[model samples]
Target chain A: MSTFIQTLHLAWQNTNSLLCVGLDPEPTKFPGALANRSDAIFDFCRKIVDATAPFACAFKPQIAYFAAHRAEDQLEQLIAHIHLKHPALPVILDAKRGDIGSTAEQYAREAFERYRADAVTVNPYMGFDSLEPYLEHKDKGVIVLCRTSNPGGSDLQFLDVGGRPLYQTVAQRAAEKWNTNGQLGLVVGATFPKEIELVRSLVGDMPLLIPGIGAQGGDVEATVRAGRTAAGTGMLINSSRAIIYAGNGDDYADAAALAAQKTRDGINAYR
Target chain B: MSTFIQTLHLAWQNTNSLLCVGLDPEPTKFPGALANRSDAIFDFCRKIVDATAPFACAFKPQIAYFAAHRAEDQLEQLIAHIHLKHPALPVILDAKRGDIGSTAEQYAREAFERYRADAVTVNPYMGFDSLEPYLEHKDKGVIVLCRTSNPGGSDLQFLDVGGRPLYQTVAQRAAEKWNTNGQLGLVVGATFPKEIELVRSLVGDMPLLIPGIGAQGGDVEATVRAGRTAAGTGMLINSSRAIIYAGNGDDYADAAALAAQKTRDGINAYR
Candidate 1:
């Protein structure tokens, strides 16, 4: 019932972890009995959640992965399963949606009311009003995309807006103006440790959902060194394929649990 | 089965109209017997499509509206209905999705394969690779956001990236580099007639999906003048709330048809 930040802080303290296990269920890569069945999307993710919850501070399910397979029912089931089984950990639906004010309200409803996620990732390309509807949900977390993990993210994100880069401007605006309800966070890719440092300095201990570790080849030590707050706890470092698709056999769940634990400990070492 | 451009040209010639009827179904705005049924999303959209098909070159269903009401099933049915009834008119899924390459593939599958849309809108903020998956669908259309109509869109869109603005950079790249398969277009809001003119000059006859008409109060005369190609058929001028919600009684469908015909003829006059 607490706000997303409070829930995240509690999860971090209780689990002693900062790792956010990402559920990007691609059926082509799914193993064993779970390969092509639409129902297995939920079955596979539920097992991973059961296995990895001990080591994660949060769970982020990328909406595109489920919607691609026409398994939105399964996505709903998975989020409900997480809330029921793992009550402490917040679920951040990685949708990255943006639109004008009227349509953005619908997207906000889909994420918070339908899918029941504690937080949702959104794109900032449409600017202030596009994000206002999500921010109106005072208790839910609204994380804005700053610097992305992919190489092409530099296309517009790194453009010089005024003096600093566009992503820096995004971080500054998100922290100063958009955080009216204290529910805003920034998605800073771990690959760009320097940008992470810059965003961290600009936001001042606000939550940063750092992707691009593990499978994306980001240096974790450098990421933690740059992104961590003075108190050493202001990020949800996400690992998707590197953890969930870590193995291809029946033992995939165990492999995922092991991967999650190692990554959690790896993040903890610097913190 | 012709390419998207060929199909669009055919539709433009056959319909003799530039209006694109936008389906943004808000249940709260529904009338009479279909006020709150989840099935009404499809029913209302189907009725609107039937009434407006004679006056439209295309139909655009904004995905957020359906997802907000847990009506993705209805969205699928509505598209199928459009194809069955009005085969000449292309359906553009206005999703505005952007992500990394691998994830973008999932989103591309969702829009093109699952939804069976002739085209889909995308955000260009992530640059080349994020859009590559969608562009890879050689036969389908890929429309990228350039200068949006919303005032908040100016926040990052108008920032000077190089010599001009970020949107111009987007238009140039979309035309020169990303139009490899001849499946590229840009979204320039109808509200900004000058920017539409600028984008039209930059992209040189590539299709422009112009929204922000009708309820958004965009000047149709200026929009058509600024966006029309030398051939006088290169734009899909979209009108959402103003046409669909023209009446709230059981006569809503008749009112919508009247509005669609008026708008279509008005646009024709300018073209």
Candidate 2:
């Protein structure tokens, strides 16, 4: 196993949970302590990291929230702060980037070399060539979008490809073909429990980052049951908005930690 | 006509050229004059905008380059500078962002509302609903990825969808169903001149953003000939690295302007 997998396994063992607290700090939903401050996003993320570092196996930072703001330095500070607060907890940058060959290589450098993210979310629309650069980082994880947890995700993902849904083909290819470096993972949305079950079956032992849990209204019990691997080890249940914005007052961090614990307990209930 | 279309038409009349310079400034490719400096990107873009503003009909900034750095401020500055320098020049934010409803709405706000781009590129993988938010801005152009200009683009794009290649189906859908607001355009790679011809036939009057021109080794002459609408008003030939990095020295801007002129002349040769 690669360093990322080892780190992930170690995290699970240490936390006694498979929960990944998604650090998607939306500006409007920031706590009162940080509401009108210039460093609101950074402060909120720092507190969340400090509060939930013991419970979360990993932290997934959605790139869109940071990208939406003009204060990019704050994003870098947030990542740096996370690393300082929880040195061992893996930071997955949920950017969902995809592009052609050389351009993709530059993006890989930006994400891994510049930001030092342990892993990243990628869109596979441009095919395997776009993913080759990320795969070169033997220690980093490349999570490809499989069956997303959204209403329109079925539009193209469910399109017939050789008498099977395109997502199934993506899953099989990711498991057999794309995981050559042993650093592959799939972003399976928890909203579609049946699809999650199908993908879990298709991709035997690969790690799965299952999002869409809380805010998206995914059935936690059904998703956890459907997403577990045969070894019962390769799953990361992500809860973003629901946990981050659990409270809008000064006790937001405590509320976030409690919300994260509840999600972890919910997943454990299914397990 | 929409604001984007009107801007392009006016730009064509003013410059007497149909060239659209693609501003994709990779940090690694920055000259020694601006080595490892973030501010260099803004300076590079401003110079290019000033040098080629009078020669080109529009400017296409590939969002991936700016997004790679997650430099939202730089992108905003770049767009603002372009509008300030060349007030009537349409800025197409080449960001192939496509997601489910709410997420798509956020992306639309980022590209159109926050950045205030005249046009934006989008992926059609998630289908109509993902693109609806973009199309709602009827005065701004929404360029859908139809037939990309990359080698592996055919892997999924050419897949048989209901007994037809997916690109053809995408073209048909864009032309018939998705073009309700008349704010649609297609991204047809310049490398595939034949596919360009086919897509042009499908999307009769809609504008086409043709990339893969200079550095990607696309045949500019054939692309312009096969991709242009019958009225000769539908193609936006984009050449990124070749024009921007035409010379690696202090004379880069002048060389880029000359390179833009050459690309424009090359496209006009076939026209």
Candidate 3:
């Protein structure tokens, strides 16, 4: 009967880990032994999930990677596998979906109903009503894109709005107006430590899903220092490419586990 | 071979219709005769497409209505059907996708490689890099969301960036920098005539996809007047529910054709 946030926090405490491993398996990067397999992406991700489950707080699977290969049903199976095997571990579907009303409802169903993701990432471009349908599902988490972890993050996000950056405005609104259901979280890139600190102050206890840590060249110490709340429990630092492809050998799963353990310890060192 | 814009202009000239029919078929709202059939959505949209082909410059299929039923294969079939029957008419998949870098490439593949949509709508919240991958495919159209047609369009879109609204800034940037591939368009809601006029002036010759007519209460005259360029060929006025559900009986396809023709003529009167 625990809420989504409560469940996430419980698992966070249980694992004592803030690391959320991203399950992105590029077929070309798969181990040579798995190249001939029909369901290579699924098999690759399942191994990553199994290897990193004990050391991770959450799992995130980017939908585009699966949908690109017409493997959406495999994504469904992956989510089901995680829930059945590691019920405490939440799966955040990295689908930055945004649309108006009924269209938003279908995206909601795609994330929560079809894949049963405990949380889903969403884009906030179309404003409140685009996300209002997802917010209605109180038991699920809706992580709104605030300041993305990309090279072009400054293009539109830095636009001045009322003497504050646009990301701050979005964070303020998510804290004050959009979290009536308490199922809201904000995404702030780990590369922008100062912005992450500012959002941390504005959003109080609402969790921030921090990307851009490993392959994206975000400093782990700065991320952990700036992103944590007063209670030291508000950030889910994600590392995908670095952990998943830590070693492209037969012991890839073991290498991923080692990388996850190192990342977990690294975050805890700063915390 | 014509470019995406050139193909769109060719179709616009051939039909003399700026009208884009949205093939969004909801099962519960389907005409009773076809509701019991398993492939009802594809069947419904095929008939609508067949009936309205003569009056439409483009066909838009909303992804939500298709994904809601786990009938993505049906959507694929519908797109294939449109390509086979009416190769001249472009199919714009109304999947408002936005993500960052590598993930964005996968989404681009989902729209272009998987679904074979000539154009795909994208949200611009993640800034330039999120839409950059889609822009890489020179032959495909990347329609960014601007001033949307929803009730909450003003929530974040109206924020003052410098002296102008945020949507204006977005339009300015998209016009100046984001059209590098020559396959760029903007989505401006028909409900806001003044905004449409402002965006048209800002973006110059870039086409605008105008949603929010008919069921959304947008006036056809104002949309045609404000959304057109000097050449009177820069607008694609879309009507979904009002035209598609014009009847609930066996004659629904004929009724849809009539509604589409009326809408087309109404837009032409102002053009």
Per-candidate DockQ values are 0.82, 0.53, 0.84
Interface RMSD score of each model = 1.0, 2.0, 0.9
The C-alpha TM-scores of every prediction are 0.98, 0.94, 0.98
User: Which residue ranges in model 3 land beyond 4 Å of their true spot?
Assistant: none
lDDT of 3 by residue, B1-271 (tens): 2277999999988899999999778888887889789999999999999999999999999998887788889999999999999999999999999888898898999999999999999988888888889988889998999999998888889999998899999999899988887889999999899999999989998999999999999988988889888888889899999999998899999999999999999999999
Q: Lowest summed lDDT over 10 consecutive residues: which window, candidate 2 chain B? A: B98-107
What is the C-alpha local distance difference test score of each model? 0.92, 0.82, 0.91
DockQ of 3: 0.84
Error of 3 at A262 (Å): 0.6
lDDT of 2 by residue, A203-246 (tens): 88788999888989999888878988655568899988888889
User: Ranking by TM-score, best first?
Assistant: 3, 1, 2
Sort the predicted structures by lDDT, highest score first. Answer: 1, 3, 2
- Residue A234, candidate 3: alpha-carbon lDDT: 83
Candidate 2 deviant stretches above 4 angstroms? B35-38, B67-72, B136-138
Query: How much does candidate 2 score in TM-score?
Result: 0.94
Please report, as a residue range, the 10-residue window in candidate 2 chain A with the lowest summed lDDT: A63-72
Top lDDT model: 1
Q: Tens digit of lDDT per residue, candidate 2, span B1-271? A: 6778777877766776778888888877777888767687888888998998867888998776775666667888999988887888899998787666656776787888889899998887777888898888889989888887777787778778789777888898899888887788888888899998999888787888888889899987788789877667688888888999998888999999899888888777877
For each candidate, give the TM-score of chain B.
0.98, 0.96, 0.98
Question: What's the true lDDT of residue B251 in model 1?
Answer: 84
Better of 1 and 2 by TM-score: 1
